[model samples]
Target chain A: MVKFFHHALKFRKDVCIGCSHCMNECPTQAIRIHGGKAELTDNRCIDCGKCYMVCPVGAIIVEADDLSRIFDYTHRVALIPNILLGQFPEGVSISQICSVLMEAGFTHIFEVEHGTRVLEDAMTKMMEEKELPRPLISTFCPAIVRLIQVRFPMFTDNLMLLKAPLDIAAMYYRRKLEEEGISPEDTGVFYITPCAAKIAAIKSPVGEESSPITGVINMDFIYNKIYTKVKQGLSGKGSCCLPAMQPLQPEEMVWSLTEGEAARMPGRTLAIDEVSNVIEFLEKMENEEISDIDFLELRACDQSCAGGILTSGNRFFTVERLRKRAEEAARGNDSMIYDTAGDSIRDHFDYLNEHLKVTQIKPRAMDKLDEDMEQAMLKMRKVQEIMKDLPYVDCGICGSPTCNSLAEDIVQGKAHVNQCIYVQKRWEQEGKLQPKESMEILKEIWGEDKF
Target chain B: MAERMQFEYNVDGGNFTRAGFASSEIKKILKKLNVDIGIVKRTVVATYEGEVNIVAHAYSGTIYVDIDTERIRINLKDEGPGIPDIDQAMEEGYSTASSQVREMGFGAGMGLPNMKKNADEMHITSEVDKGTEVEIVMFLNNKE
Candidate 1:
């Protein structure tokens, strides 16, 4: 049955070494080893590019969106993600990067961080109103949001349901530019995104019917443009459009880290950072271990936005520097931005009602268990009975983690029982069954009688 | 086909390193049974929390798990120091854990509260000098 959305196109099969790097890193068990290849289950994929970022072979590449339409606009604006800050270390300042983008046929550069400020203000109001449910997970990363929608649907209500920082920034930018008499059709706002998930989010947001983003320009490609302009602007003071907003000094940049989202909001909330920690927290929340807390800020990456897989900075140094920078930029109190941004955008930004439409797709009925105590016991006995005859090396050369992981895989219809090494060896030793016969037996045990 | 399955786990309070073993085994068992992910996760968290509580707070105990068509029921009976105030323990961030337990990141005073959160229905009976018994029930329904 065709299931998951056509989001993750960066996954190239030839480059996948079956290292399970993507499997381990993926928030959902979407990518699994099926027939010795990294097979993604359409039902399981949230299109969160955690796998894309961590793949060693660069096997996964997010298909770049066609932003040629943005060139159609008389006034084009590039919204740069904060992680781009890590790319330009030695040569150019952020202002210089902004100057470069203007020279690159763009009219202006609006740092997406500006949207972060709006979100911060909105979150503060959200906290004060206490309108959101306990453990309000962040909705900044579309992949993470989709992860909740698909894998953790029960927790979907627990999510903030608000638009991400980039989208918030886009909303404000569009409205502000329109107010200045700039026609909405003539103004194109493209995000210089870190990952393809953002690009896909802009193209097709799951919760919302439409997205504020016009298009995406990959940060990897645009970093060179920023560099070229940095060199040219330094030599000759190039005439270019000046950005309306400035980088949040040094202290404000700390919002790039893992817990920065929660810290920015003027509220009493818990900010749990890191993917493992986020998983543990979600598991706890699902179990109902944590409640009554007003807000929950979760980022799949380790060190917030600065530590995103798309960035080039050393995670440790970037986090330390970003922390100091955020503190310095904010002038010690992080709430200043929220207090000063006024209430217009802040009030609207935090107002999120999911109103999501989802079809809870259960697996085919033949896969469903009897749920009988006797059947479960009978299955367990058969599993043990099968396990004893098989050697328990768990080499995974048998294509399973162990005789046990294989047993579970077989029972779950993820694998055939004959894949067990012991079963194969028994067929070899007993001479009663051929390899094909052994495979047929496996299929039969797993309820695949058609084999 | 509503069949009943019962399993018993011996939880030892003597060792901290061996904690979560029972829960992990049960997770494997549930996975093999092709139970729903929601049910498996809830059972894992509940059993793990209960097992950890037994080792951390109880003298020694046993967890009885009954799996049926309708629900998964776990009854944890322990001879450990009973809860002094169940009401206070239910609150978030409220804990009786010591500094040593805090060092291991195990005791944030979140154990009982976590258990209560995961289980659909929970009942606790305890005495300070005698022992503690916690019973939890989780329905297998797909909907919340």
Candidate 2:
């Protein structure tokens, strides 16, 4: 079965230092090093971009758009995320930075604030209805969605079916441009993104929309260009000169932070971050231990998307900036802002279908014992028995990540007992290395090193 | 009823934080077997709920899991205060958990219902003051 979904992140082997940093640090344990090179298991990788952050030599990269297509669109909408608002230097608003984009050739800038308000209103109604299962897991994070697919498919029903705010923003404009007599194909929406997962989301969205976004431009990929423009006196706009640009309210801006959506949920809720901690909580939820939880907002980054690997600023610094700006914007009159007026913002999301559902996917099976259950039991016993004969220390010297893994690999027919250096040296010292099985092991173990 | 292999776990009821460890381990084993995803999901959900009940409501328990060619069966037996009314226990939102447990966001009386909904076959037997035993079975090859 085709296991892993499409992932945009790439691992460049030539640049990899193979320090085992990505291998040991992977939350899902998707990466392993063999022959001094790193390999990512598609089945185990959730595309959370964890390895990208941990790679010291910058071997991991998400394919980036050069922004060369911006001029191709007759009407361009630069969809600046709220996270980007936190990236600029102090005293410079995002509109000022966006003005730099306009100077770079963007026709217009549409802040993704309207979609945030629509999500708030729609989710509030869903919360009030209380129709779905308790603890509705937020579907906003693409990495979290993939996490469920590959690790916790049982909770598939719990994922909120609403399209992500990015999709909503893209669809919202594609139609608005069409309504204004501009061809839908003529209007291009480019997302200045925070992570590679978002870029993957644009290419293969969970919802049914085929290519909701026209293109995606990575945050750090264009940071220097925009920063240089700001340095070149293209910024410092006093008023909102960008067309269709709306000030983001505090509630909408908080969505970029961890637990931002769950805070709006008044009942028992949880907002979790960091891929490892997120897995811990998800295991409890899967066990039905935390049924009282009404909502869960989970992010793959340590502190939310501000902590994403694609961002320019440090997480703590940028989160502070984002929160401060959002607080100031919340005190204003942004269109479709969340307030006590209790009005429906469904009209804002009219470009999207009334009901959008994420395509259900399943996890890959990596450690199957055998095709036959009866044979599988026999294999299990053999593995356990072989484990006793080998050293217990979990050293990853034989290309396998651990001693236990090497034993399993032996049983899986991927490796042999002699691949272990300790086993080979012990046999050689004891003068028992003449056995045919031990000789075969001797050839492969040292084939790359000594043989 | 003969099984190819049976696994056992001793659940420590004292630590509510470590309640899902056994269930997580079981899910890994099942995944390694290349079991059907639907069956694996149900098995994880149902038995996980069973495992948590031992931690939350009972004193201590032992979970016995038997993996067969066509099915997976788990029986969780606890040695603590048992339910006086099994039917009422199955109802949603009827929990006898202490306020402390409730404060931690558990004990909404949804655990048993979640177990029943996920398992292909579920059987619960309880004796007042003796203990409660939950048996959940999920078929691996049942296409329907």
Candidate 3:
């Protein structure tokens, strides 16, 4: 199988229970059952990590960056997700979390929400200038970017030129270090991500520009370590402070929640969460029905990034916690970190002055069944003809993802119609299959073994 | 094996949720057949607009799909009050959709124009208080 996207996810075939959960849940229908085991067809995979989320037996795993590599860089900057602030207990301050992370061996801490604020400012500028395409699509979620690249290639123009917030944070941190006499090769920017798709993005960014991230750290992997470190009083003995940049606003912190972006953009906007829902919306968007809208945010996770596969807490609980925290922060209950009264916070843009992203990206289509348009049309007509005869139940008993998949597999000579249980039963009732034919099927499935 | 395939679907009117079902099915079939994605996308746009037109305007309708090696022709016929002025209805922003259908994002008067834009050939004939029939033909071999 061809290597799809970045190999951000690893598979352990030893623990696979052959439940087919991952196969059925895949949005791209990339997984198929072969010889009672699940196999991924890398050509169609967008590396969305739904298979990793759906695997019940712990067979599918995301490849986590080795924490030991962080020591190799002279300056190691950790980028924290806003959702992580809500993952902690009710009383833990942002300073406390940063202190614990610093104690845990990080040289500098950069909040992902700061990157979000930067993007909001840039996007606001773009909106005011009308520089971007209408109905601007967000690149916050890497899975959504890959989805658009693979499935909705025609909507590539609608995608906003801005990269993910982590990318922005990494760029900011690296530039600041580079100006301070630190080389790019000597400085590391680590993103504590909540999903495999972000890891994929860190490995291979959407545009032609190089990825800014040096290492991809899984959130849930270090959740308990940070919790224990904070509980044991390893750091934050008193009120702590940060002199780097400003803290995230209430509206900015909730960007991980569903419709969080739309809540800020007051217009005919649309927000869709969940992979299937986003796919449907993208299909509709591809038809150009959403031109009346200004912004469209499509998230692949259940409750946006808060409900990611690597998150330790439930999505609803995290959102509720964030809501309460945002309320308290609004009332000035939380301790202040960054020096908001001085001009130092305003100098944050100085970091991006020389490192602003300037690149172009074109559509990278997944695959074409046939190269010739006329031959492709003939193939489609043939699929329509084949589909009329098969059962329309979409039963995955044939080892394909859907009945349409089975039809394609048959046409591609990868599968036979007899693999369908319904076909087998009908054949048996009609005396179409002899004892010899049944043995042939057994040999095909289990290999030349006498039973 | 059927060298030439034709699919017929009866589109029930007033079922907004199910309006795109036939078109979605057609998309899946076209995708499975390995059709050019651009052509598949155009066919889906035209076919879906036609299907939605039936669900939003007509009481009941029948859609016939004729596919060969060269083209996929979709003809939609409905049994309901038809457009009185076909030219006026063809114009952009000219809609007779009720507030209920418009609120559901079904009718923006972009259906016929979009169908015409996507399909290589389009023909619409209607009679007042009778019914309307729409035919869209998309060439499979065209680059545009």
DockQ of 3: 0.34
In the range A1-451, model 3's lDDT, one tens digit per residue, is 4454775777676777666888899998888876556788765677678898878888988887877778998788888888887787767767788777776678877777766766776666656656666787777787887787777766677777776677777777777777788888989888898898888877877674688888988898767777887788776774443545655677767877888777766457888999999998876665554458888888999988888888988788888988886777777764547665633323676565344453555655654555554565566666667787689888787778788888778876788888766777778878997656865764454334324
Q: Report how far off residue B78 is in candidate 3 (Å).
A: 2.7
- Per-residue lDDT, model 1, residue B91, is 84
**Residue A348: error of model 2 in Å?**
4.9
Candidate 3 local Cα displacement, residue A378, angstroms: 4.3
In candidate 1, residue A65 scores what lDDT?
52
Error in Å for residue A407 of model 3 = 2.3
Fold similarity of candidate 1's chain A to the true chain A, as a TM-score: 0.76
Using DockQ as the measure, the top candidate is 2
- Candidate 1 lDDT over A107-199, as tens digits, reads 766656666666565556666665556666667766667666654555665666467767766777777678779999998888887666677
- Backbone Cα, N, C clashes tallied per candidate: 20, 2, 2
Candidate 2 runs further than 4 Å off: A1-3, A128-131, A232-240, A333-349, A353-386, A389-394, A403-413, A421-451, B1-3, B12-18, B36-61, B77-144
* lDDT tens digits, residue span B1-144, model 1: 666677888899846787777776676566545577667777778778888788888778998888876888889899988989989877889877778877766777777777888778999999997888989888876485
Give Cα distance to truth, residue A195, candidate 2, Å.
0.4
